[model samples]
Target: MHHVTQIKEFKVIDTCRDAVVINTNIDDYKAHAHFADIRGALECISLINRGLLPKSRYYKTACKRLLTPEQYEGLVERTKEKYININKGVRR
Candidate 1:
């Protein structure tokens, strides 16, 4: 049998109007769970920075959490400083 090389392209038809409204209520329990997730992830990163991999598992239970850009940036800085201090002591 011979192989076919050319492939056919299909056009996507747009037939839906942009006038849809979705009303939903966000429960407090979900919000609190998300907050706990962010806090736990931050704590895990902190633990990893301190070179304690085994203890980091304690903070890996929550999910679907959101963190602000500023908070993430701050966490990065804090983790960096932690490594810096660790290396500083080793080089002395």
Candidate 2:
């Protein structure tokens, strides 16, 4: 028997002095979003982490800092579970 695991990871695909692009890994088409800066990008990530925003939609960034390491890890775990439950009804 074999067991397979799927890891959902987001990547920062591009960065510039005034903007950054991150591949959010939530869409089948590999959707990416643009932010004015790293702080903005991280803020979007944080909102997604907290469940305050929906994963299937693109969001604009706000002027805020990233979450703490511990906070982020906890949120990631919760988000993963939520995503799994949400996908249970859909056949892939």
Candidate 3:
């Protein structure tokens, strides 16, 4: 039998310069690093975009509940751009 992947929808519950909270059908998840700056957050986002799940157990679980790889890549791209704009005020 062929297995199919389900693409789940994600909602940005809250976000700031240093952190973001996301919600999906499975559960709510937060992405943040204590004592880290915006750069750290950007790095984290990059890793996620590259298919590297966060080290935190909660994040690992949440990653499994997210969208398919293709859909997720699109979401990550948009999110990264948003963060960059908010932090650097870069207009494009």
Candidate 4:
């Protein structure tokens, strides 16, 4: 069987009262580019755009639960956390 890949997208409307989830697959190299580590900072913001999950609190919950691996999990996680929380409400 072929392996499955998942992408999450969120859209929000009316003071967070509306939300949705759109799913897609990354079949090639470039398809995964949108989700690169350099892109992690805007992940939650992007998720909000499609509406699957809420912003702020959900993002904070995700950040707080992030665990680092002993080897390849330091700079990436730290940078992502900083970018995600820098403005909290605004995503840059």
Off by over 4 Å in 1: 1-36, 56-92
Shift in Å, residue 49, candidate 3: 0.9
The CA lDDT of each predicted structure is 0.27, 0.42, 0.40, 0.32
Evaluate model 1: give its lDDT: 0.27
| Model 4 ranges off by over 4 Å | 1-16, 26-57, 60-75, 80-92
Name the weakest run of 10 consecutive residues (lDDT summed) in model 1: 3-12
**Which pairs clash (backbone N, Cα, C closer than 3 Å) in model 4?**
10-49, 10-50, 10-51, 10-52, 11-49, 11-50, 11-51, 20-51, 20-52
- TM-score comparison, 1 vs 2, better candidate: 2
Best-performing candidate as measured by TM-score: 2
lDDT by residue (tens digit), candidate 4, 1-92: 22222334322121222222222232222211222232343464444344334235555443223211221123232223334555567856
Per lDDT, the best of the predicted structures is 2
Sorting all predicted structures by TM-score, with the top scorer first, yields 2, 3, 1, 4
- Model 2 segments beyond 4 Å from truth? 1-8, 17-21, 24-30, 54-92
How much does candidate 1 score in TM-score?
0.22
10 residues in a row with least lDDT, candidate 2: 60-69
Model 2 scores a TM of 0.39
Question: Judged by TM-score relative to the true structure, which candidate is superior, 2 or 3?
Answer: 2
Residue-wise lDDT of candidate 2 within 1-92, one digit each (tens)? 22222223445433444444334433434244556565656666656545454343345222112222333344432255334576567887
| Candidate no. 3 TM-score | 0.29
